[model samples]
Each structure stands twice: as structure tokens, then as C-alpha cells.
Target: MAEGDPSYIDYEAFLDPDFSPSSFANTLVTSTNNATDTPLDLSTPLSRVLFDLQEIDTHIHALTTKSALPLLSHTQNQTAAADHILKESGTQVAAVTQGYERLQKEVVQKWEAADEARVAAENSLATVRLARAVSRCLTLGKQLESQVAEITGRSATGAATSVGVDGASPSAGRDGFRALERAAYTILSLREMFSAAAEDEEGYGLDRVKVIRTLRGEFVIPTENMIKSRAQQTINRFSLSSNSANSSNGQSSTSSGYKQARDARARLATAATTLYLLSPEPKSSTTAVDYKPELLLSTLQGYMHTAIMTSVNSLARALSQLPSMDRTLADISTRCQDIVALEASLKTLRPPPHPLLASTPTAETQAAASTNSNLLQPLLHALDTSSLPSYYWRSLASSLTSRVQEIVNRGGVSARTLRSNRDRLRIEIKECVLRASRVSATSLLAEKGRSGTDTVIVGNWEREAAVMVSSVVGPLGR
Candidate 1:
């Protein structure tokens, strides 16, 4: 309202929900006149109040009339929106219910068939695995049979063509060794397969099959035994006597004796390799009674034992007959050379990996078998030395010490002769070491084509020579 007007009203104050008529009247009266003024005229104020009320009512009517159509239109639009939303929600809910029903129906209809298909797939896979296992078993069996036939054929041919007094032919020996190696490889393959099948969950009943059992009993075990026997025989025939004679005569490589010795070594190497392949795995049992040495190691240890015993006996006999000392030393040196040569041959020989082993289920086993193929490592480990020559010499020294002590304890002519030749004994011991080292080096150089200027030294040969001399001379001096 206008400030100059006599009938002005604050219509905005009346719109407040908390507005009170008495409070408004008091404020208006206070704003119009102070308390010191004459009492307010009631008639003028009442008239102005009525006029203000009429003006406020008119403005309210006009505002309501102007907003009527727009309010109706807004209400209708809201109602239509609510109906459309309800219809769309019903349609979506119906579609979802139908989709759920269809999905449940499909699941109920196909559950049994799906289960059957899964089971069939599993059965098919198991059958395939079983077929593969059987195929491998039969293949190994045939290979084993073939190897046996070849070995037998070679043996028969060797027997028929026996021109020598010993009934041995070089070609026959070579062929026999090759056949044995092949047989051993086949047997190993079979054993590995059996082991793998035993560990495999899918390879159920493989070992119990009649054909597998038959092969294992009739062919595998017997062939394995035969190979061991033949290999042991070959190792036993390894003699230093022939080698010593050939060396003493200064025979050329073309000589019959030299060629025979070479052939013998070749056969020995092949046989050793075969034995290694056939050797059983090391047992896990820690008990001494339960533990058994591998076949190859035991055989090699026996060979070393035999050599030691023979040398001790020969040297003891020579101590009595001093004239034989030179010959005995020569023989011992030849034996050392043979040992060196054998060590070289074994180190150089690497057996081919079995083709089937790679395809076997056990990779750790394949790796282990490959590592065990090194023939020299096992012997060296058993002998407890890195150098074979050093082991042999040191072992001989230790063995001869007691023997020489016993002989000198008798105080007879042998003892007197040994005491008189103490200096000569020392010299002879040194010469024996030098001769063995020289000849072994020469043979290795010739075989391997090593540089001529390369010096060959047996590990601590000087100490070994001292040990040998003391073993004999100490007793004499005492």
C-alpha cells in the first residue's frame, strides 16, 4: 500500500499463518501515535480497517480467478503421467514373468540329457586314455621281442663263425653289445611305462592286463637277467695281462693284440652302459638292511675289489722273488692304464634318450633317468673320489700296507732282501707311478687326439708313491 493513504494495510502481514488480529491492531495503533497523544479515535480506525479488508478480499478473488484454468490443466497432465507409468510397469513385469517361466521349463526338460551327455563325454575320454595306454604297452612289448630276436641272432651267428680258439669274433661282439643295449633300452622303457601307469589315476588296471603280465614275466624279466649276466661276464674278461703284453712288445695300433684290446674296451663300455640303463632306482628307505646298492655300482665295486686283491697277491709273491718285481710293476701299471682308459670311455659315452620316456606322464622321472645316464659319476661317488686313478692307487697303497707289514714280520730272506733294497723300492715305486701316468696319458691322447704338449698328472701321485714306499720300507727299517 501507499504510505500517504489514510487507509493503508499490510496485506502481506495477514498472509502469514501466525498473524494475530490483536497484535496487528496494537502495532498499528502504536505506529500511528505515541502513548502521550490523546486516546486514538476508534471510528476512523474502524472505517480504515473495513476498507483495507474489502481491498484484500477483492485482490484474493482476482488471483483465484486468474489461476483456475492453469491449475486444472496441470492436474490433468499429472494424472495422465501416473496412468502411463502404471501401464508400462505392468507390461515389463508380465514380460519378466513369461521369460522366467520359459527358462524354468527349458531347464526342467534338458537337465537329464545334459547330465547324460557329461557322463558320456567322461567315459569317452577314459576309453581314449585306456586305448592309448594299451597301444603303448603293446608297442613296447613288440620292441622288446624284436631286441631279443636280434640278440639271439647275433649270438647264433657269432657261435657259427667261431674261427678263434676262444670262439669269439669281433663283429659278433660288437653286434651282441649293440643288441644288448637296445634290449636294455626297451626294458627300461617298459619299466618306466609300468611305473607311470601305476602312478596314473587314469591308467587303472593297466598292469593287471594279461598281455602286460605275460610280457613282464616271460620276456622283460628274463631279458633283463640275461643282459646283466652278459655284461658281468664282459667286465670280468677285462684283463690287464693282454694289455701289458701288448705294451711290452710295443705293438702298433694296427697289431692284432692292440685291436683286440680296443675292441674289448668298446664292448666293455657298451655293456657298462647297458647295465646302467637296467639298474634299479635308488631305494628311499634309510635303513641299512632295506637299502640295496644299484646293480651297476655293485658290479663296479666288485671289479675294483678283485683288482685290489689280485694286485696285493701278485705284489706279495714278487716281494719273495725280487726278480718278478719288475714284471709285477709293469702289470700294475698296465692295469692303471686300463682303468684310466675305462674311465675315459665311460665319460665320453652318452646314451641316447628313450623316445617314449619323453611322452611319459612323469616328467620328474624322465629327468632323473637322464641324469643317471652318466656312468662315471656313480662309480666315482661309490669310490668316494673324483679321480679314478687316484682312488685306485690310494686304495692299493692302503691294501698293500698290511700285506707288506705281514711279510716283513716274518724276518726271513724276503724281509732281508726288501730291507737291502729299500732305496731301490722307493725308486721303483716312483717309476711305476711315472710309467702309469705316461702310458695312460699317451693312450688318452691317441684316443682323444689331445695336444701332445699337455701334461698328464695323476692326482697327488707323489704322495701315493710315498705311501706305497712307506708301506713296505717302514717295516723293513723297523
Candidate 2:
């Protein structure tokens, strides 16, 4: 074939496994001759094919010979370029490796330095917070100490002062109550500070500080105990004096006597308020048996217990005597009146919020404190009764039931009298309940103007009277 010719024989056909040289030759001869004409000679066409193959082979040899030197030069140039690129790449890789190592060392050093600085800053912040906590503890301790001293000084000087006919100097009582309030507030503040420190991570070590420990041991603990003792003594004294006063007065005291009683009640209220302020936060115990109530609540409950015991004993003795039943029931009515008075006083004794106690003073918190301000609420909660009078009568009934049963079990003359006078005993019990209810109702009318008819009683007197009579008469009948 000539160079760049469009028409050419397929050289790939000669390499094909199925290619037949004889069939190709026959086809070529048949294509060259007509069907009815002379048959073409194979030798002539085969000689022409052989000549064309020789010419094609010679052309290929000539072209290869002409291109050999240029191909060799191009290959040599490519190899040199590759060698140069490889050398440059190796040098750059080494430099980059050195740079990376130096950068890694610098970054590691900076990171370590920054980490140490951060740790130091955090430690310093913690130390500062701890110091502030210790300072606050010391401040509260000093305030508590001053308050205790004031209370002590007032107590010491009050005995020498010109006391009222009832033995309490008005000025001294006022000063004593003020000092007690301040001391209670200070104690509460110190307690809250300690509680906050316990919750804070930085201030956790505050209790371990030497001065703090000393303050707690010397001032905090002793002052708390002293205040608690003083308040408790005051309450006990008030309860006793009130009982005696009620017994002597018999609802017919003069105006001056009423004034004295009012003053005594005011003093009692101050002491109760102080105790309420000094009351500890209620803790959740894991079990009911492990639960302990507030100190103020326990004290009030003790008062109620005393009242129950006294009433039970008096009623038991009256049952034995039978003739004194009327007098004994009257005394119980007076005791119930005292209970009503106590409940009213407690309901009215709302302690003002301490400035130090409220950390974040808000309208909502103030309102909540005001709403839950009743000093008697904790006592009521512990007794599980809303009405103190109701609780007292019910508890008396239960105790009196057992006492009556014990007396009847003896089967003596006293028991025989009790069974015979069961109807009279029921009437006296009902009269006592009605009298107590009338007294409470009269007081309420006096305070907030008369409402409804005079015949209407204030509480469930019928039910209470029935309960008391049943407890007493039921045992006697049996």
C-alpha cells in the first residue's frame, strides 16, 4: 500500500485463526473473471499479491530506519527530566519533614504552658472563693457573739429593774425580745452560711479552718444551746402561769387583770416567735421511725401533752369522787379555752423575714413567706390537725377512755358510782364542751363584731361532747 492511501487490505485477517488462504485466493480469482468468460489464472493473481507484500515490507523498514535516532533522543530527554524532578522532590520532602518536626515541638511547648497557666488560674480562683467563705463565716460568728452578749446583759440587769406587779419589767422584756430576735437571726445566718459552704466545691474545706472550728465550738454551738434553753424555759413558765391565771380568774377577771394577762401573752408570743425563728430546717429521713420534727413543734406538742395529762388525771379523780365531776369538767373547759387562746396567738405571731436569711429577695419569696407566716403551722402539721382545740379534746377523750376503763376494771365503790351517774356525767361533759365553745365564740365576736345569733356555738361542740361522753360513759357501762 502507498503511504496515506484510503483503500487497503486488512492485514489483521491474515492473523485470524479462521482465515483460509485458498478460499481468499479463489474469491479473488472469481471476482476478477465473468461467469461465462475464461476462468482467471491463480498463479498470476498470487504473484501480484506476493509483490505487494514485498513492497509493503520494504516501506515499513525504510520508515523505521528513518525514525530510530529521533525516538532515542526523545527518550533520553524524558529520562533526564524525570531524574531532575525526583531529586527536587527528595530535597523538598526532607525540608518539609524538618519544618514539621520544629513546628510540632513549638506547638507542644505552647500547649503545655497554656495548660499550666489555666490550672494556676483555676486554683487561684478557688482559693479566693474559699477565703471569701471563711471571712463570711467569721463575720457571722462575730455578730452572733455580740447578740448573745446583749441577751445575757439584758437578762442579768432585768432582775434589778423595777418590775411590774406581774414580775416582768416592760422595758426589759422588750429589750430582751429584741436581743433574742437578733441572736436568733444571727444563728440562722451562720447556719445558712455553713449550709451553702457545704454545697459549694471551693468552700467545702471551710469547716476544717482553725478559726472557723473555734468559732463553731465556742460561740455557735453554745449560743444556739443557750438561746434554745432560754426560749424553752420562757414557754414553760408562760404555760404554767397561764394555767394558774386561768384557774384563779375563772372568766371574771377585772380590766387590769386582763391587761396583765395581755402583757404576759405578748411576752409569750415574743418567746414563741424567737423559737420559731431559731427552728431548724426540716430534714427528710429515710424512714418514718427515723424522722425527727422541729424543736418548736416538739415544745408545742409537749404543752399539748401536758394539758392532756392534767385533764385526764383530774377527770379520773373526779370520776372516783363523783361529787367533784362538775368542778373537774369546769376546769377542763378553762383548759380548752387556754388552748384556743394559744392557737389564736400562734396564728397571729408572724415573724418578720430576716435580711440575712433571704439571699435573693423577690416579691414572690416575700409573698410566700408572708402567706406561710403562721407560727403555729409546724405544730399543726406535727399534730396532723387544723384546730388545736379539736386536737386537745380528741386526745383527752382517748386518754380519758383508757383511764376510765382502768378505773372500772378495779370494780370498787368509785366504779359503782361512775356507772350509776353515767347520765349526769354525760350532761356535764356536754356542758363543758358547750361552755368552751361559747367562750371561744365570744372572743371571736369581740374581735370581729358579732355575727349570727348568740345561741350559735363556734365549733363542732356536739360531736366533741359526744366523743368525750362516750369515752367516759362507755367504759363505765361495760
Candidate 2: tens digits of C-alpha lDDT, residues 1-478: 3456543667677779999989887777777666676755667677768886887787778777888899899999999999999999999999999998898789977888999999999899878887888988887777776666555543432343456555655554556655776777778767766655444543467776888778888879888999888877766655322433442343444233444556556766767867767766544312211222267777788888888899999988988898888888888987877677678778887655543332444676556555556777767878899899999889999988888888889988988888888888888898898887755333222322334532225566788888988999888765
- What residue runs in model 2 are displaced by over 4 Å at the alpha carbon? 1-118, 154-174, 197-204, 232-295, 321-330, 350-386, 419-431, 438-462
**Candidate 1 displacement at residue 315 in angstroms:** 1.4
- Among the numbered candidates, top lDDT falls to 2
For each candidate, how many residue pairs have backbone atoms clashing (under 3 Å)? 0, 0
351-409, model 1: which lDDT tens digit per residue?
A: 44443322343666556546555577767877888877777788888888787788788
TM-score attained by model 2: 0.61
Query: Quick one: RMSD of model 2?
Result: 10.6
TM-scores across all candidates?
0.61, 0.61
RMSD of each: 11.9, 10.6
Instruction: Please state the error at residue 176 of candidate 2 in Å.
Output: 2.7
TM-score of 1: 0.61
Local lDDT at 71 for model 1: 86
